[model samples]
Target: MQHLDDSTRTELEAAAFRRLLHHLDEHKEVQNIELMILADFCRNCLSKWLVAAAEERGETLDYETAREYVYGMPYSEWKSLYQAEATPEQQAAFEARQAAKQEKGQ
Candidate 1:
């Protein structure tokens, strides 16, 4: 951290992001709702953030396009191939977590 220049840090961060995308592609069984319930973010959140980052730089990036990048395919295709329905427990936990976050004003 101390010695790295800005360009080096940026390159490393991009590499890490690519690694994360690769990991997610490899683990299609890990559903997005589970990610939201456990970590408060999911693949769609990454797509939204990607679109926001593009907007911040005065570029236009649509959610579906960004989702294609994140999911390694068209969103519908990815969903058909890998997405699973959330179980009752996952839904309940997600609701509870959202309520807690709302109470905390997060």
Candidate 2:
């Protein structure tokens, strides 16, 4: 990686990102709250990041469009098909995770 050219490095990173999206799409049962509790990011975070990246590059990307790209469909469709209500235990765990992050000044 250290020896890779800039374009090659960027290509590899983009490929990895696509792979991540595919993996997440394949695992639709994984709830966003679970992701936030464990990794501090979810599909929505990815969509926001995508929009920010496009803006940084002087490109236009709205949140809904980014979400469609990430979710393989409109977010509303995906939510209605696969999203589930978080259990009380999940909510508690997410709250604890947030508290821990705040305590660590993250």
Candidate 3:
């Protein structure tokens, strides 16, 4: 990373991020809750980060556009295609992880 110029490194990083979003979008059957449980990040988080990065550079990236970028289409379409309600056990496990994360931060 230190050896590469900032622009090159940034381009590589953005490309990698795009690839990840593409993979996730292609596998829409994988729910955000599952991503959060497994990787501690979700599509929403990725979208938010994209928007934040754009804003940091004085670019005007709105939420919907960012979400579409992350989803590889409109979010509603993605949700309709693959989103599902989590089971109680899944919800409980997520809550437990959240609690543990918060505890660690303290």
Candidate 4:
């Protein structure tokens, strides 16, 4: 909020991010593709954003490490543990959604 000091706002934002990660972890059955289809972003997207932010700050943060941070374990482990193959219908819907976004220049 505009009334909050910078440090307080940053702390609150960081806390919210942590809570979001915790919530995602709690809902492990929710796949990344489903998130991308519904919300346009997923844990992997968060990881990439984290790396981009580090780069902007003149730091080097690799994708795998960033992904591990978001995933709470190595991404391969997370995939094996919780990720599922999208059904044919889900894949078709995802493709349509992506095409619509592209057409809209989103």
Instruction: Evaluate all candidate structures by whole-model CA lDDT and list the values in order.
Output: 0.95, 0.97, 0.89, 0.95
In the predicted model 2, the residue pairs found to clash are none
Writing each residue's lDDT as its tens digit, candidate 4 over 1-106 gives 9999999999999999999999999999999989988998999999999999999999999999999999999999999999999988889989999999999998
Off by over 4 Å in 1: none
Q: Which ten residues in a row have the lowest lDDT in candidate 3?
A: 21-30
Give the count of colliding residue pairs in each prediction.
0, 0, 0, 0
Candidate 4 clashing pairs? Answer: none
Query: Sorted on lDDT, highest at the top, how do the candidates line up?
Result: 2, 4, 1, 3
Better of 2 and 4 by lDDT: 2
* Candidate 1: residue 76 lDDT (0-100): 97
When superposed on Cα atoms, how far off is each prediction in RMSD? 0.8, 0.7, 1.3, 0.7
Top model by lDDT, which number?
A: 2
Off by over 4 Å in 3: none
TM-score of each candidate structure, all chains considered together: 0.96, 0.97, 0.91, 0.96
Tens-digit lDDT string for candidate 3 (19-91):
9977986787888998888889899999999899989999999999999988888999888877899989879
Model 4: how far is 56 from its true place, Å?
1.2
Model 3: which residue pairs collide?
A: none
lDDT for model 4:
0.95
lDDT of 2 by residue, 3-102 (tens): 9999999999999999999999999999999999999999999999999999999999999999999999999999999999999999999999989999
